[model samples]
Target chain A: MSSSEMTSPEETPLLEVRELSISFGGLQALNQVSFAVEEGEIFGLIGPNGAGKTTLFNCVSGLIQATSGVIHYEGQPLDGLPIHARSLVGIARTFQNLNLFHGLTVLENLMVPVEVRQRRGFIADAFRATRSRFGESQAREEAGAILHLLHLGDLRDVMAGELPVGLQRRVELGRAVAQRPRLLLLDEPASGLDGRETAELGALLPRIARQLSVTIVLVDHDMALVMRVCDRICALDFGQVIAMGTPAEVRNDPTVMSAYLGASGAVQVAQR
Target chain B: MRFDRQLLVRAAMVIGAFDVLYLLADHVGANYRRLMTLSAVDGLLVLSLVVLTGFVGQISFVQAELNGFGGLLAGAMIGRLHWSFWVALPLAVVASVAVGIVVGVPALRLRGLILGVVTIALALAFDAWVFSLDTFKAQFIDRPSLLGWDLSDDRATFAFCLAVLAGCAWMVANLQRSKTGRMLASIRDAEVAARTSGVDVTRAKLLAFGISAGLAGLAGVLLDLTIGTADKQSFTLLISLNIAAVVILMGPNRVASAFAGGIFLRWGSEILDKVGVGGKYLNVVLGVGLIVQLIAAPEGVVGQFSHIRAAAGRSLRRRVAAT
Candidate 1:
């Protein structure tokens, strides 16, 4: 069931998650967390390990099912749709772990989702979908556009695995952008990068969101990158939403501070 | 990133080089020609495996069984129904593609070793079911004809197989550059990443299976045409094992390793038999070669070539600068 307060937002939130919960066996990963990401906004989902950040991502992307909740995208419910369907609806995401095919070239990596987006829907499959000659040309054009945007047009021929860690993340990002998504969910885009790489990511990310008109839901542990890129932040502790506000508000909140450093530890750390 | 004039020229140059090679090979000795034909057939099968295993990252051990479906269908249509080879061949391909979809639906749900086990079972089942039926054996003993021409002759069969192999290669090469190829590659690398990136894992897997199975079916039709009969004994489980081995042996960049593996199989057998040992010894050698290739050249021979070329390019550039 959706929250009654979901109607409060007038701009028609790009992604609306209400009371979403998920669990593996008996261990609950996400617990009744409600939030809405506005269109073209950089939204952050932050938490300690096992705080259900990735789990929530999995739910919205349709990789994992929500045990109880409603997730709406563009006013349509995204509860039972498979992962690819969510992708077709302009919802794209990356992984917490690097998920690039080492064997393929960087260019090949970017072409994948663009091809999917170029595919005609289920009706096309049933009625000689491939017979439509427009599909192939469109796919090629879209794929080329994505690769060019990522500045990976040069590395297109190079094997994806051989690239450095920073480049791989960009490749992953490029792959997502290729899908032409309205909402992009990035799971720890700055996980293994150094300060410079992270800063480069910081500069590149906003341009991507602005140019592509994509709303971002980034799940990260890096406060610096998150604070820099994210317009708003949602803090989770133990599967529950403990704080949600602007970066400054969430940064100074007592619950968020305590959640990061224990109840008494926050004061001690502050004093030091 | 820009598709410049130089890139187009390079692509044309590569295609032109192949044409020259193709012309040169046309005048070679019969034995070499036969090996080439076998290589072509092998390449077709290997190309299928590359799409399924290498590109899609689904380890399928049942490609031989899928080929068997093509060979058997061709035999049944030609011998029993008196159908033309052209008609029978496409019929076989369609049937194989259907089987691929059916099997893929179940197999795709299971990943890693589980998917491997399930597909292997399908391959084993194809072998056992065909060999066990006397009616199938008796009724299906016939030559596969193409365009009303009985294609039992070796020379004609070689030409036909070579043409089909080239066509198959072209299709695969185009796909490798296409968006579908990228999607499968991404899915193979990381399904979660691909899925979140808006790629549908299941559909991509299914398409990969279909492409691979279609190629296998095409190869099977060519095989039956060469042998003049469709015997269940011809497409052994070992063929599946060998194809998988070939993929591993060739590594990733060498999509053409399928052809190389075929040539190796043809030459390696004769060399082994000429040494006074029987043809059975070839499998042992193949097993060893497969193991060595997996260990020594897991990137396959093509990967090694690229590596050497890169190193040579670097050295040459340095020398030129110094001069």
Candidate 2:
């Protein structure tokens, strides 16, 4: 067998977006964008502001419907599923701005997603059945484990809003991890972090991908961290893919250099 | 285990307070008993607000209308169909929940003040059209006699109303600590976050509405029992506004706070009536209280009490250190 076949014999891309387009009134937010993310790969989506990176993530997570085209996950069409259904089917995400539940504690924030996976109904909960308690304890244990893994064990009881931005981001990441998702979408995870915190996150992402065997799709403006961590990268300009390849190949591409600098400066950067 | 201990302490305090009130009513006279019974029913109604406005952060102005629907159904079932109180109560609650879902599903598209507007319109419609129907007239109710005891007896009815209030309070407490409650709270704080976390946002909101409406329906049955009639005036749009005002003034976080709100709403009005001010002035008092609550204690009276307790503890600790 070939080396590619040896790695993944049943090689089916985890996510495939085809000719997706969405317009807000007269302006096109995303214009016929398409890409495929393979299993267990740390795929990076990098672009300047207003390049429609978040808009694409929203479309993939089912937060907003695309005006046209199809999205396939695990080889099945994700046409009519709602946001929660998409999450249940192993697609979990975090927001660019910290969207942690302000009323809940760090532990409680993690438990919210875990509790949703429990089978106990509201009647069972209201009645305080043994099954409900068992489900609750299980969720708590899962949340605790994720907290420990993320080094947030000490801040378990801290209100999410009281935490600093770095810690809040960690809590959001821990929450998504607690869901035990097969695919995780993170929007600007390194946006508010200092250099040290960004480095820690850079190391943490690959470790998470390796240990959990989870594919990651990350959108961010941190080029240094993105180049170091992501196995493959896709760069966008004007809601269209300008370059898509391995990190080294994308970095060498003239279009990417021009997109970052300017059309005239691409040659100078490439020469250097 | 810590959670259980806290819950146990809260339960004991609530039951003990109710016991004291019950004994006091027994000695004071029928007038006091009548007031306490109304307060108990109001307690249930405020709890409906606790689930929706407090936990889910959905402002609704139609709780009284939902309460009226329950009373109307109870009157029809017990009076016309000759059904027992036990049979009519659950049926009324279920029917009210169905109506709540119908209203709640569409209201989900709107948020904050807009949703409040829709609910106000609904309350007006219920008062002007639904409650005025001939079938729901106050004369149609029939008080049930359960297990050799007639609920028509003032003392028996008071005790029965207290019992129902206790059950509802216990259930509300249980729901607050459960996963369902956490999910609802999450939605309240952040809807998009809750949705991305795998919570069915629509379903959670609908369930909150149903539970809120169900509690109001249960209160309606008790209200009808207390008065021995289904008085449309008691469940009017103005009454709904008053109930919402009370919840805002008393805090909606804990079940005990809802009970406290109910007592304050009922007895506060009685005090004004005794002073020759009458029930008409009660709304003016509530409006002033609501303003004070917003400015001084946005978390409401119960939350303010906790803050005071915390401050006192800190001061005591500082004094000990200084000495």
Candidate 3:
């Protein structure tokens, strides 16, 4: 329930991306980068464009086949599993670009995962009429609760695409969380959010991580929000890890400063 | 607001009236009833198109080929092997579903133009290589019969077709409401996103295609029985185009569009016949209709209605809030 309670070394790491590497034809996108996210902690993956932030997320979620590496998810090796199987194993992710079903309503979007889970009990849902009625009700209630949590309960009936970019991102996040996963991978969640929206996201991220008992792996460009929300940060440049430490340490790390602010930015980091 | 009991009653009345009219029309003129039966069979085939291309966003011209597969199998069993139509029907459906699964394995990895090209190739290959063979053609030489039921008449075949169409409609509706349906929808909307959400895109696509083909195959068996014959010309690539036309006209979400599309197919042929035109010109008309529908209503007829209803609901809500 609490962040500190989730940090025991003996307990399983929710996700462990070990020496993960990937390539696209002539270029290496990810190179022997390793990181571990503990339960209920907000872990941030930060880098500039082409630093393989999204690629890392893809590999972890099993969208991209790793060139060579192991992804241990909650003590189980996730390397062999496909993306959806990873989801069934309690891993859910939101895309960098909003991927909400534009034609579907927000509630329906949330219901997608629930319906998928219900499919395992398809015979029961179809034949066991009494139990199915209760199951359907419970699924709807959970979807509603998720919508409510994301402050989009009123928009449940509205088309997801009709919502503004900020709300759409929120809905995307909500759908991912609706799966009730142990780990949540968010790819550049702050991409389009304005300063105020970013600040709101900063405040909301930690609250959601705690509320849902989900370990958050946030990849974002908003350094301020990342610094504020993430318990630890991993900085990457050219597919390799530049720095890995607590937010304050990473913010002050000379290597991280150079990765973001260039060679001269190290002085500024030291000054800060 | 009152649960639209009047709408329900009106719908039931119309359906009942049509059924009675169909029965009477069968007695009055068997040919007219035969045409209605044809339309229902065509409607069932079109339902497959609507489900695969419309709902799941997998473009396969092989739907007609799948239908052909059914016809050929039914023909071979009943005509050459002297098997009953009852035995052939389920066998044909299963065979087509197997073929669909085979095609889907490779086809699922392809998208858009590539997918279209690949499936069209598959359809062409099926026509040229399999159907043209003497061994294959030899199987479809006799009249078909069901369990103690001769399908040589109009009324019996019409009832059978109607039942098939109803089953296809129910199955599609159930699928669309199921998790697999949502997964296919997600893949259609955004594959990458769906993949991240833990959806097996390959499996979803295969299932969609398999179900679509199975429905088409079932419809085809019914068609072969109704016509009392299986001809290569009837199961040509043009049938695929016609199926696509129906899907374009009716859209993806509504099963009723299948029937609407079938009626259009029948009317197009009839109007062409009356106007001294031929089946060749029907293609031209269908092509134009497809282009127009894509431009005017990419979501198809049902989509347009839903859009309008949604807009109306929004306006009504705004007005209520203002009050």
Best by lDDT: 2
The digit string of per-residue lDDT tens for model 2 on A1-272 reads 00111125467789888898989899788888778899999999877678889999899899898999889999999979989888889999999989999888999999999999988788888888888889999988999999998899999999999999999999999999988999999999998999999999999999999998899999987777778888888888778888888777777877787687854334443554
lDDT of 3 at B257: 81
Going through the candidates in order, their DockQ values are 0.42, 0.74, 0.45
Ranking 1 against 3 by DockQ, winner? 3
Number of clashing residue pairs, candidate 2: 0
- For model 1, the TM-score of its B chain against the native B chain is 0.85
Summarize candidate 3's per-residue lDDT along B1-323 as a digit string, tens digits.
Answer: 45478859867986896688566657757767777788888888888877787777788888888998888888887887888777888998999999988988767678888988888888899888888876457344344445766556567678768766876676676556655566677877878777666677777788778888888888778777777677666777767866876787778667778877777776678778888987558878777877887899887876777789999999999999999
Fnat per model, in the order shown? 0.65, 0.76, 0.41
Consecutive 10-residue window with the lowest summed lDDT within model 1 chain A: A1-10
- Candidate 3 total steric clashes: 1
TM-score winner, 1 or 3: 3
Residues B1-323, candidate 1: write the lDDT tens digits. 56578879977886686566566456676667666677777778888888888777788889888887887788777777888777888999988888888879875679889988888888888888854565346234444556766555555667677767766766676566555666677787777777766676778788878878988988887777765677677677888988887677777445677677677766767777788887678778767866887778667777777789999999999999999
TM-score of each: 0.85, 0.93, 0.89
- Quality class of the docking in candidate 1, CAPRI style: acceptable
**Candidate 2, superposed: residue stretches over 4 Å from native:** A1-10, A262-272, B1-15, B140-142, B273-279, B310-323
TM-score of chain A of each: 0.86, 0.92, 0.89
lDDT of candidate 1 over A1-272, digit per residue (tens): 11122235457888888888887899988888998988888998887778889888878888778889899999889877877778887888888888887767776676666656664542332232354335656665676677788777788789999999888998888888887889999999998989888888889889999998999999877787787788888888889988888877777777777787854434432443
Model 2 alpha-carbon miss at residue B135, Å: 1.9
Clashing pairs in 2: none
